[model samples]
Target: MNDYIIRATAGNGAIRAFAATTKNTVEKARSLHNTSPVATAALGRLLTAAAMMGIMLKGEKDLLTLQIRGDGPLQGMVVSADSNAKVKGYVFNPYVEVPDKYEGKLDVSAAIGHGNLSVIKDIGLKEPYSGQIELISGEIAEDLTYYFAKSEQTPSAIGLGVLIDTDITVMAAGGFIIQLMPDASDEIAEKLEEKINRTPYVTSLLDMGYTPEDILKLILGDFDIEINEKKEVEFYCNCTRERVEKALISLGKEELEKIIEEDKKAQLHCHFCNKEYNFTENDLKEILKNAL
Candidate 1:
């Protein structure tokens, strides 16, 4: 099934929920970075959560970035998403691996030890809004839940998971975020917590061919849910040859001349997409002219 995200209001507008399936999107990132099993799981979860957060924006150009700095082998991770649901990300160490935590599941928590979770939201404003919280579990879901409760003062439950195939490709990936809105009653919050604790693994449900809507039904069965909007999500990078050229030009004419004199060509690689750009001596000379 094509990747998509759903936004809905449950419990008569007393709760806001979001669910997303990101199999294809995460697979794209795995292919681009050639990440190992552990890195694939870590990066995949962050990308899925970032896509859902992207949908929370109000304007077209709004963007969100999720950064995790941990002490484990994976070290750190960064994911970026825009209002259009276009997302991309990379890990500091894509080859880090660890033994399974339980039942042979990926040891994502071990790969990402205690650290910090930082979120930056740019909503076409003078200054982007930013927040930081100590990592709750080094697991993306728990960290996100902590952020919402501490930073936004919204009680929330977040579940994110990614299943990797034998070949290290993403098999199934998805997540759900449920928030208690204003006017939520204590009884409602308690019941909602019970439901969340009992719900099946989000990734397993997606692997069984459940759509985003079906996942929501499993979580908020008795409550009235209004589907607000839906949008396609993907792993898309906004890098191009033109942008690389502009970057080289900004290095100044003297620097370009130095590169031309020493090496016949220059090599540039994007950390996010892992695509390499080659610039011949002629290209360097042209960029030098643009610098002046």
Candidate 2:
């Protein structure tokens, strides 16, 4: 099924919520980076969370970047999302596979280890706003929940999950974020917590062919969840050969000349998408002219 995200409000707007199905989205990252099963889960959860966060933007160009620097084999994970629900991301070590933690499930926590979670929000401002918090459990979901509560001062519950098949392909991937509004009452918060705790994993629901709305219903159950908007989400990178050429130009005339005189050709690879752009000596000369 195609991936999509939904924004909703429950309990008469006392709770703001977002949910998404990201199987295809996450699969794209897996194919691009060739991430191992554990890496896939770690990166997939971040991408899913970033997608939901992206919809919260107030402007078209606003962006949210989620970065996790851990001490595990995965090292780190980076994900970026724009208001349009376009998301892209990669893991520092996509091929690092670790054994399952319990009951033979993907060991996301061990793969992530303990580190810091930093969120940078760029809203076309002079300086972007950033929030940082220590990882609570190295589990992306729990760490994000802690971040929202401590860093953003927003009480939230986050549940992110990615199910990987034996062949390393993603079987399912999705997540949900439920945040308490400023006027949320204690009773409402308790009930919401109870509902969320009892809800099934987001990926499991998606595996059952559940739509974004159905997933919301499953979480909000008896609560009044009003669907606000729905948007399609995908794994997209905004890198281009021209952009790469401009970067090479920024390397200055000396650097360009050195590359042309030595290698005669330079290969630039985009870390985001793993796409390589090759520049011949003539290309370097042209870039040198522009650099001057």
- Model 2 lDDT, full chain set: 0.90
- Per-residue lDDT tens digits for candidate 1, residues 153-232, read 99998989898888878888989899999799988899999999898887778678778899898899878878898999
Residue 244 accuracy (lDDT) in model 1? 96
| Total clashes for model 2 | 0
Evaluate model 1: give its TM-score. Answer: 0.96
Q: Can you list the residue pairs that collide in candidate 1?
A: none
The estimated TM-scores of all candidates read 0.96, 0.97
